[model samples]
Every structure is written in C-alpha cells, then in structure tokens.
Target: MPTQHKNIVLLIADDLGKYMGSYGCPSISTPNLDRLADSGTRFDMAFASTASCSGSRSTIYTGLHTHENGQYGLNWARSHFQTFQYVDSAPKLFNQAGYRSGIIGKVHVGTEEVYCWQVREESGTRDVAWVADRCEAFFQQATVDDKPFFLTVGYIDPHRDISTRGGFGNQERQYGTRVPLLDVKPEDVEIPRWLTDLPETRQELVEYYKAINRTDTGVGLVYEALERQGLLDSTLVMFTSDNGPPFVNSKTTLYDAGIHLPLIVRQPGAKAGIVNPNMISFVDILPTLLDWASIPLDARSSDKDSRLPTSPPRQGRSFLPILQRTDLLPESDWQHHVFGSHTFHEMQNYWPTRILRTRRYKYHRNVAWRLDFPFAGDLYASITFEGIRNVEPPVMMGQRKLKDYIFRPPEELYDLDADPDEVSNLAGEEACESLLLNCRERVTEWQKQTKDLWLYRDGQSVTMLGRYAKDGLQVPERLDFDVENPGTKGVEMTKHLGVDAYSAGIER
Candidate 1:
C-alpha cells in the first residue's frame, strides 16, 4: 500500500439510509456498500445534524451545527447543545495529526475519551462476533504501531430496524436487492402515523434487514482487516450514518428521513466510480480528517473547536473538491446550508428544532413552545435493547399505544422539488410565501451566525442558557436534564404529531 498520510477509515451505520445499492436503494444488499460506492465518492447530498444519536455525532465530530455542537440531545451531558470537548474530538484531530485514532463499534460518541485510541464496546447490534474480534485486534494494533491511522468502525445493525418501528428485514441486500417496504402492507404494518405500526412493525423490519446483512459482513471484516494490514490502499474509507432511520419521523426528527445519510468515500487517491452531488455535513468530518492528515485545525480550540475562536472558520467545507468531482458543486460556493438542533428526546423532554436543508429546500423551525411528537415525548428514552423492546407494554401492546401518535409543529417548509416524501406543506404554500420568508431569514441568520439566537427564542429563555452556562461548561452530564415539563399538554402533543409525523416519512 503506497504510503502517504491519508490513512483513515470512518464507518458508521446506525440508522443508515441513503438506501443502498450505492444510494439508489434498489432494496438493500449493499455489496460491501456497493463496493464502497464503486471504490470512492458517492454523496448525493449528505445531511445529519439532529436526527438524534448525540445530535448526529455532535455534528460529525464537531464541524458544528446541532447548535454549535452542544450535542443537542441524547444525554451528552444534558444537552442545550455545544460540543468539542470530548477532549477536542475528531479522533483528537487525528491525534493532533500524528494520526492513530481507533474506535470499534458504536462509540455513540461524546461520553468522552477525547478522540479515542481505544473505546471498544461492541454491541450496537448483537456484537457481530464482538465486532469481528475487536476490529481484527484493532487493525493488528494499528499495523504494529507504525500508526498513521484514524479508524472508526461502528454498526448497530440498521439501528435495530430503525429502533423497532420496523422494516428492512430478511437481510441480504448488500446491493443484490430485496429489502423493500415503501408504502407498507406486509399485513397492515404501520408505525409512523407518528408512531405505532405493528405486526411488530413488520417484525422490526425483518430484523433490520438481518442487521443490514450483518453489518455488511462486518464491513467485509473491516475491509479484510484493512486488506490484511496493508491498511487497504492507505485507508481513507469513510462510509456513514448516525441519524436517519429508527422509525417514526426518523430518529429524533429533523426530517429527510431524519437527516439524510449514506455518504461513501473509499480511498487510494479516491476518484473511482464517482458521484459527489455536493451538500455534505456532519461538520465536514473534522476539517476533512484534518485536511487528510496535514492536520492544523487547533486555532486555539474553543467555540467547540474553531467554529470561530480567532479566525477559526470551519463549519465544514472540503470534500477535497468533491473528491475530484462528480459535478454537484454549487449551493452558492459549495457550503450548502444545513443546520439542525433537537435537545433531548424521551422523558426529560427537550424539543428544540431548527433545521434548514438545501438541495431543493427543507426548512423546519419549531423552537419548542412544545409540539413534536412522533414517538411521543422526548423519544429515544435510551434504555436500549430496542429501548426495552419498544417500552414493553406487555411486549407489544399496540406498539405501546404508539406513543399516542405524536403531534408537533410550529413551522415547516419542504419542497424537495415537489416533496421527496416530505409530504406537502410548503409552510402554508401561498406560492411558497416568498420562499418561506427567505427560508426564515436564512434560518435567522444561521442562528445569528452560530451563536444560535436562543434558537430564535419566544419561550424558555434563560438568556442563552445563562450565557453559555458560565464559560460554556462542556460536561457535567453535558446539559443534564432530569425533568422540565412546562406543559400545554406537552405543547399539544408536539403539534398534534407534527403532520402525522410528516406523513410517516414514506421510507426508502
């Protein structure tokens, strides 16, 4: 394997959905993620900030968004959102650029190990032989310590059929095809009329496509243990998914199947069977893996690692020229506006959503005067094992009242070109009320240039969480919530289940 500093492998597949067969989803068998998207580049507009799962990996290892990365939800310190302190993540900026940063399975991220060299807790989906024997002994201990690495291998198998709302079972579609479930009917199947579609939601999507064909054969056994340690053509194999899927309105809802995912890359100077339709996010994977190992980003690390600290500018922008181009490079200079936020899901209730997606529009701004119930109240109440097997109301008592069919919405605008299943509502479509008021004033000036204007406040203002909770304290249970329901019937059941959870997010 010809050398160079570009050795990195980021593979996540929790709620993965850009439907496989290299993003065309002819129905599942992701032939080694379609040969890693035909050996390189396959984005088709990637997105994810808050579709839950620690607000989409705290906006993909802190490239911001998820309200500046406070992690906006999932007990990452209680979460009012603000991140960068998992010891300055992004594999500690590839371990301060000298590289060597491993993580086996489901490092849900931000519990903290500060850019992991080791955080092996395999079981995001029936341990798959303990993550293929702990990622083949963590790449044979990072190629016998000649470490120029940045490995991440997480798989929670089709996020347990999208957290048990179900559909994607009987495995085998690694690009060979046959996981179908778009307009339901495998026996009255239902679970997203804002929640609750049973027959075990199609037997939990056929055990989530048999855990996505057993995490694509554990990502072809970690790409054959990085091609038997030659580190697969100098690594750089980034496949994705942390949000989107986990049923209902798509993991903690920010829509686009809860944060449109599936972004392939593969490496060896990239550029193989390409297709990079721009609009990437997850905060540009730590300055594109610190600009492919040349590193540098530190800029006095604050404001969650350079969203701004002293000319730190980087909310992500560098697909290295779309990994050598497949065309889609213009959302006015490639930074395709995308932002999302959703603090806590399930129980301690926190619904702070603010998203603005592009590639034909999607804007949702519901600053929680309360109302966003898909799987009812705070969702993802993290008890795991499929949230105690869908909160076992007698092990499946009408999908446990399908959380009384969630309801919530204060604003929503979708037009993914006449709705890419975002099901109508151009925010009161009067010929797109002046393009939804200029996408809500460009999402309130990108939430006041990232200071997140109290998420466009109107209620619950502790004045910027007490001016960033005194020096933006990053972890003490992050944003620690135990209870805070100021009611209005939980804001009218999160807006009467926000348009039937956006028309049961017509899956893919």
Candidate 2:
C-alpha cells in the first residue's frame, strides 16, 4: 500500500479568503482546514503576487509575478492572457525529472503543452468526492509504478457563479453525503469588515458558506485519499487559494483582503501545530516544491531556446527551511516584506497596480489612477454591488465610501498598525513624505527587476522608451507629464533610488 517516494500535492481553491476557524474567523468554522493546520504549519502572512485568478496561479506555477510571467489577466479564448511561451512552469520541471506530474481540475493557465502536465483531467466540478476519487486513482497509479508524483487538485467551490448575481454554484447540484452542505441563513453570518453589512451581502454569505464547507470537505477527502494509499508521511501537501473572496473590495484589488491569503503546509515528519509568521509569497511555491522534490534550480531553463533566452529568474527563494518552524522567523532569516503586482482581471479591468507590503506599512502605486477603477464582470453583477450602487448618493462599499473605492489617487500609503483595513491614505500627508518615498522607491525597484511595463515616468513607460536617449531625447523626471513648464533640460533626471549604480537596494 505504500512507497516512501517523496511526492507533492498542491490543493488550490478557486476564490477563497482567510475565513477558516484557524485564521480566527468567527462566522464559519472550517473544521477540516483547522485539522489540517493542527497537523502542520499555518502561515500567518502568506500573500499572492496578484489578485486575479489566472495571474495568481501563474505566479504559483512559474515562481514569477504576473508582470514577469506574462499572465497579467484572466486566461480565456477571447482574453488571451496566457503565460509567456518561454517560461518554465512547475509541472515541466517535475516532468523533466521523471516524476509523474498532473492537474485534476481548472486548467485555466495556458497552451496545453507549455504547462506539460502528464494527466490533465480538467473540470469545473465542485464534487469533492469525485475529485478525491480521481486523486485516489492517480495515487494508485503512481504507487503501482513506484514513481514520485507532483499533483495539483484545483477546487472550484466558494467562488461566485458568473451566471447569476447570488449563486455560488451550490443550488443545482448535489455533492453527496461526504460533502454536507451547511444550512445557513442570512442572519447566521457575520459580514466581513471589507464588505458592507447589507441584506444582499448577508444573503450571498449564506450561499458562500455552503461552498466554503465543500472546499473544506474536499481538503479532508484529498488528504484521506493519501492516507488510504499510505503515502501521507512521504507526501508534502499544501493548501491555498487563488485570491480573496469574490466581493467588490476584495477580489481584484491589491488590498490586504485580496492578496493576503491562507497557506498551510503539511511537510512529511514536520513538527505539528506550528504557526509560522514569516511573510511568504505565492512566487515561492514552485521553488519550495522543487526543493522538496530535490530538483536543482539550474535543472530548469535547460529547455531554454537561444531565440528566446530572456527567461526571467524566479523572484522567490524556497521557504522549505522555515516551513516546519513553530517560532516566528527573524527578519534576516525570512523577509518581513512582500511585493504585489496586478494588471487585470477581465480584459476590461486593466488598472495596473504595484504594491509593497511590510509588517507595518503598505504602499500602492496605481499606474492607471486616472481611470476609474474597473470592476470584474461577475462582481459588478453581484446583488451586493447592486445594493451598494442603487442606494443613496454616498454609498459605502464596506467601511469605505464607494466613490473612494472607484476614484483613487496615483499613490496610496497606509500605516497598517493604525489601519489594518487600509482605508486611510497617507501618501499626500507631509509627515509621511519620507515613508512614502521609501515605499515608492521600494516598489519601483521591484518593478524594474520584474521589467514591469507599467513603471512609467512622466506618463511614459521608461523601459519602452529606453532606445530614444541616444537621440538627445530627455523625458521629464516626474511621474506625470508637466504641461505647464515643459522643460526636460536642467531638471534633474529621476535616477535610481541607490546612491550609486550596482547597489542592490536603496537604504534609509
């Protein structure tokens, strides 16, 4: 019934927030996820690089941010937001190492051959039992062949159904006895601080809770499958979500409600009941898995083409060393800050935002700040949003005004210790000038490293216009173009944040 082969199983949820009991949510108790946390380490400050579904998943697979990986939006036939053709993904690296790699749901990322998953049973089914059955068969096959496996089980629950404003895809189908649908009412839920506590929001939460339960059941079932195969100890399992819950202020935004996620790792023979407080990123997922699989970092890019040799390096290092620790990692041992990149959700949703989030502060640079923030198609159609907009003039989305949510400034800085909800803006304040500048420069350096096209100066992309400097062309050293005094000469150029070139980063 067992082989001691090292294996990896990544469990990804569709659109989930940190709503489990383990994360201190009082609304719904996620017993399965709580049990999972009890058996392993639950990271307190895990983050996704982007908030969009495909974009976030791309970051996890390729260990690069959305801007760096070329999946800056949803991957659809019409949207065409696929990963860059030359990028190396997790499955390819595992498959190349003679490991059987496969994904058993929601293959949303790209051209089929590029991900290179050996068995791709793509589906949108929310049936946890059926999904576990497929995983059980997959494990059985791997056990028979005595080959190590890299499996990704993507769950499609807890995400709002785009077909309607209030449906969570739980109305039409029966998920059987293994997955007991929670009988919830509008009155039974406590609304999140990120959403307005309206009747519409409460009504949607009833349906949302049922889907969350199904996701919890799926996690339990998948783990049970591993137990049945006696591969529990040999396998390293991970559970996380693509982004935050599907709400107006949560899903597609770079706010904490969006990118701040739940990441639990059950490494084999690791200490149980560990609470790891290191700031981890979704970009580190592939590297951690590769490390656990004993695959060298250089083993990737072996398939690099000479014609397309500009493969970006993985922006995250492996967190394998810190995954089993119960104590908080020191700043030197683990980074206390994480960066975020978001460009789009739908094709219409194209507001590019780069973010720098530390333990105390958050900085956001909205490149398309002039444009009114666009909403995702499903989010806009939601009954909760409908209720918010069809109300009084000063409608509130959650605790913040709807107008403030729609119209945003180019830069936003927040002291997270004072405002964890990120409602206050400090970028325009005189007292926060030094802090704002520090955060802005930090994000800018990251954008430069990721080669982000949205890192613009004087309203123009700096990298896109790099070749024009030899022609005596000098752009203004400002964020936006100056129409009043249009003089590029004698005005100092906005140089890098470093005192000199060749330095890694600017210090205070």
Candidate 3:
C-alpha cells in the first residue's frame, strides 16, 4: 500500500505529570486520555530535559537541550529567555515540509521569528472546549489548503493560578462557555507517593484533578473534531505534559516526579493499545515527527538547492521505528538513561540542577547546593505549604526534610529499585561511591558536549576554565575537568593563562 502523509496534533498539558488514569492514578478521572491510551502506545519512561515550562517546550520544539537552545528560563518573565535565532523550531521545520503548523494556546517558548507558526492563539483560558474549537478551525484551514497540518494545543490545565488561594483555576469561562466541572472529593484523591497525605494536600489535589478532567474533555473535543473532519485516521496524535504538577519538589525539580512525563502517541497505520517501557526524551519529539511524516530533516536545504541550512545536529534519535513495530525492542536497543539540566524556572528561582536517570538508579548534581533552594512563587503560597509551615518542627513532605530539601548536598544518588520514592540519599555512602562517580562523569561529559553553563562549582564553570587552559596551553584537544572533585586535579595552565587572556562571551 502507498504511504499516506500523516497530520500531527500535539496536546500539551501544563504542570501535569504521570497522574492520569491512563498511567494508573487510581483516583483521578481521565476518561478521554485513558481511551486515547487504549487506542495508542503509552510510553512508561518519557522525560523532559528540563522541568521548567519554556525550557521543556523549547527542548520539545528544537530537539536540543535548554543550554543549547538558549531558552534557559521562563519566556513570560523578565528573564525573557528565548531560543537562539539560528535554531530551527518544530513549526519552522514542519512548515518547510508543506505542513500548515498552528499552536492554539500558551505559545510560551519564545519570539515569533523562531516559532513562526501560521496560526497562533495565545489565550490563557482553561476552557478545553474553546481551545478545541480553535483546533477545529485550524484543521478546517488545513483541509481547505490541501496540506497536512501540524498543530500544538497547549492547555493551561492542572496548573495553579495567580490566586493566593491554591486552585487550578478551572472555573474561568472562555468564549461565554465553560465545560461542566467535575466535583473531585478530597477523600477520594489518591495522593502521589512524593506528597504528604495531609488535608490541604488532598484539597489541592481535588482542584488539580478537576482541571485534569476538564483537560480530558478538551482532548475529547479535539478527537471528535478530527473524526468529524475525517482526519482521525490520517493524524498522528500525541498527548503529553510540559512538566510535573506545580508544587514543591515537583514542578521545578529534576526528580522523577518532575521530569517523568506522560507520553501517548497514536499514529496512523500503526499497532494500537501497546505499552512501551522504552526511555524517551522531549528532544526526540521533533525527529519523531519528521520521521513519521516521511519528511527529511534536511528536506528544505536539499529540495530548494539553496544554502538554507538544516538545523544543527539533533541530540535526539527518532523513536518512530518502535512506534510502528508491534513488539517491544530489547532494553539494550532502547535508550536506557536520560539526562536533565535545569538552570531556572521563574526569575528568582536560581537553583541549578543536573540529573542522570537510568532504570535502576538516579543521580542529581546540585550546582547551587549551598544556597537555600528558592521556590517558585506559586508553590511557596500553596495551601499544602501552608499546612506544612504551621506545624511545629515543620513536617517533612515525602521523607524530605524542609531544611534538607532546601539545603541539598552537592550530589545525590538514589537506588530507584529499592526506593522508588527517591527518599534515600546514597551519594555520600561508601558502597555507592563507584556508581556516583560514574554518574557524575557521564553527566559532566554531557554538559561539556552541550556547552552547558551550569557545569559550575564555586561560581566557576570547570568546563569553561578547562577550555581556557587548553587554549592557553596550546593543547591539541580540550582537557577534562574533574567536576566531582573540582580543583583537586586538572590541566594546570592557570599560571600561564591569565584572566585577561580569556574573552567575555566565549563560553556560550
């Protein structure tokens, strides 16, 4: 049979983690997502490179880490971080391949030049039906133009609003209509293992779950619209979240609760209802979309015969092969580990962290371990935190001391097999020394390769300093700095290379 060009619809939920009914969150109602999962492949170990909204979305769009993409912090904040002008975003790539790309809501990644979407609706409403209506219009336009379309519908559901009182803000009306909200009882809420089982926590979860249900309705509306337009079978639909829920130790952190996202991909002419346990990163989304559409990454440069360059080398490999296959590939063939780099979320939240996670273990290198980890504005004022702060001695949330959580060590290692909740710290333990060293080395290597600025200790980037040493020493290759034990051992060219020798803006 001849291949058919597939339309793409990507649905991204803000501040949602693996808390859906499809992912077996026993209490939260997500019938639409559950049904979609039943008809598609569900990825068990999908992770975002960063837990911050813009950074994670930029990674998804460009298939490059936050460090490489230059969107290190929130786009909406004063930080005004955006993707590099040289970077090729997902919409630009898809547009090059004759796809009419549109983003419905929360286009939070960067400047318009980088994204360059044909249609953009930047509404902040939590109304799923309203957003779905916009999706329907985009699909209709695609049909009229006779072009396969790529649409990203970003939902602001399940994220705490600006209200001082903790709530998901699901009650806000859009287009003079509101989807009937679900009444989620606090008693019925199944609190995640990472959060404390307090009354305030449960009450907050009730609001979160209600917002999720509303998001589910929005998903259903989009699906129905596709079906009505006879594009359901021709569209490759994906549902995922930007990061984990907006709370302490989840939204802005590098732990599993933060980076581990829910991924469901339903491709046309592929096997359905399969659960794949392969580890996939947000960076893989671009390459996967291109592969699925049978569009080459360098299609524009090759076809136009113009010097228009292709995107810089992608960091992620396409998983479309596994998506099409019926049987799950061996663990060896699949990506076994994922890396994360988080520099900032809001303007004030400057706790930089790097993480490496495998099936059995996870390691975190907290760059600013000495400083008290600053909280995202919403989390600090949360009802859950309200409960925690009022208690004497300050109740710990999920085996994490309020003090310990804030004043973390330089390194943290957890045996995920034994302690899935990631409560135990094995970094300083003698028994786990080798594993910690290996993880540190791997993460540092990645940082160097990506030219990560967060590879810092004592406010100095070891990677940058090593580069300066190699340049001054006139070495053939760059020298590796001992990130684990900084200043202990490395190419000692500082005596020969003065601070004046290094130029500003050389470390990007």
| lDDT-best of 1 and 3 | 3
Model 2 backbone overlap count: 0
Ranking by lDDT: 2, 3, 1
Off by over 4 Å in 2: 1-3, 496-508
TM-score of each: 0.35, 0.96, 0.90
Tell me the lDDT of model 3 at 300.
33
Model 3 global lDDT (CA atoms, 0 to 1): 0.81
Candidate 1 versus the native: TM-score? 0.35
Best by lDDT: 2
Model 2 C-alpha lDDT per residue in residues 90-173, reported as the tens digit of each score: 988898898999999787898675688999999988888899999999999999989999999988888887788899989768
Which of candidates 2 and 3 is the stronger one according to TM-score? 2
Backbone atom clashes (below 3 Å) for every candidate: 53, 0, 0
Worst 10 residues of 3 by lDDT: 496-505
lDDT of 1 by residue, 1-508 (tens): 4244467778888776665667665555668778878878887787877777766775677676655545555643434333534235675555655666777767655555444555455444444555766777876766677667777777766665333233333332332222222333344322333334444455555455556656776777677767876767767888888887566556776777778888887768656888877777777776777776666654323335433223224566656645768776555667766776666654355667687888788887776635645353323432222543555464331222333224545678877787675655568768889998788777765665555534333253322433444453221211112256433333321111111111221111
